[model samples]
Target: MGLIRKTLGTALAVAAGGAGYLTATTNLTTPLSADDELWSSRSFKRFNRHRNPSIQDVCWKSIPLSDVRPELRENEEALTMEFCRGAWAGYAYAPQRAIMSITNKGPKTENQLFDEQQLASSKYELGTRFSDHFEVVERTRNSVTLRGGGSPLEPGPREVDGLFVISAKLNRQAGTVDVGLKTVFFNSAEPTGKKPAPFFVELLHRYYARAMVDDGARRLTRKTP
Candidate 1:
């Protein structure tokens, strides 16, 4: 299995650097209009943007959790969700801050897409799996970013086809400053997976769904912001 592991590792160029490793994940936005397609019958066949989550908040805490790691391996008896950071072995060659166009091609789904081997190539395991039922359609771009927090701050938002930025907005309630974001993914990828790639895709789907919710919550919640 080491042969396959190393082969997969090299195929993805994960050994090229120290920060290239990272698990694959995904996200979204937009308020649906009454006549909007997201709420139309074509899309409603499977998805209901109507029931789509409300921002529930305007300004918030930490950035969304949509970028968390993707994996299922855990040390507990419970099959709970986890995004362990240390588990990411190498990430220098991994895909981060990626941007891609995904359209659901599934007979029963929409907005599903994948990019080449990102599902399992490199670091930042981010650490856990995305959502299940999520599938690939097309990749517009794939890029990554490494963030360094406050205090002299280290390197940050190193590269991108697209990137995230802090967004400011008016707070009617607080009459003070409010913050959020504008995250856009780069479009540089191919939808292909090898050997265990299918498994990776499945895991990606599951992880994405949860991450979207968590991320939105983090970004929209007044408590966290």
Candidate 2:
């Protein structure tokens, strides 16, 4: 089992630094749209237009309608909720809870940090807090945006603010539902032009973003018979 895991990880590293990685535990699919279209998406525009030194990334994976859980196949909103829930369970949040634990804080489970009922609902009010750091700043039928507060895993308002968005859209022509996970990080002050993040920081950021979208899509799909 250990040998198989290592070989698979090596294969994935070769396949998709620009492409993807896959395993029983994780899957990273190629982008669902062309580069031009993806970069021009509405969600992409939100950060690109306003923040000067901001780093923004959007990862997308398409799941065939037939592959999704039967109950959520036709419901974009529910699919979005499910994706949000699954993304929180990605590699990022485990350490988040652990760091908080050192201080005797944080929730025991991801569900407690991100309430199942709230995640499943379409009506998340602005300012709804999650964990000790994140809060819903925007929400719609098929999308929700969270803003981070001060925490060891997140920067405070004084330095930088973090935004994460999860969304699902039905692509009827393709007979698939596209799930998107986006993240933005930027200083809170006025525009200072484009300054890229440190190499390792950007690397880790992209990996985490992809893991989240992949994990979320996996949950929404059914195992093949």
What RMSD, rounded to one decimal, does every model reach? 19.1, 6.8
What tens digits encode model 1's per-residue C-alpha lDDT throughout 1-225?
999998999866743331221112223232224553223333222222123222111112233222222221121111011111111111311233232223323333232222323333322222112222221111111212111111111112211122222222333354322233222222112221222123454344333333433333232322210
Output the number of the lDDT-best candidate.
2
- lDDT of candidate 2 at residue 127, scale 0 to 100: 59
Q: State each model's CA lDDT, in order.
A: 0.25, 0.64
Error of 2 at 3 (Å): 16
Off by over 4 Å in 2: 1-50, 104-125, 149-156, 194-196, 222-225
Question: Number of clashing residue pairs in every model?
Answer: 55, 2
- TM of each candidate vs. truth: 0.19, 0.67
What TM-score would you give candidate 2 relative to the actual structure?
A: 0.67
Q: List candidate 1 segments past 4 Å from native.
A: 1-40, 44-199, 223-225
Clashing pairs in 2: 16-19, 16-20
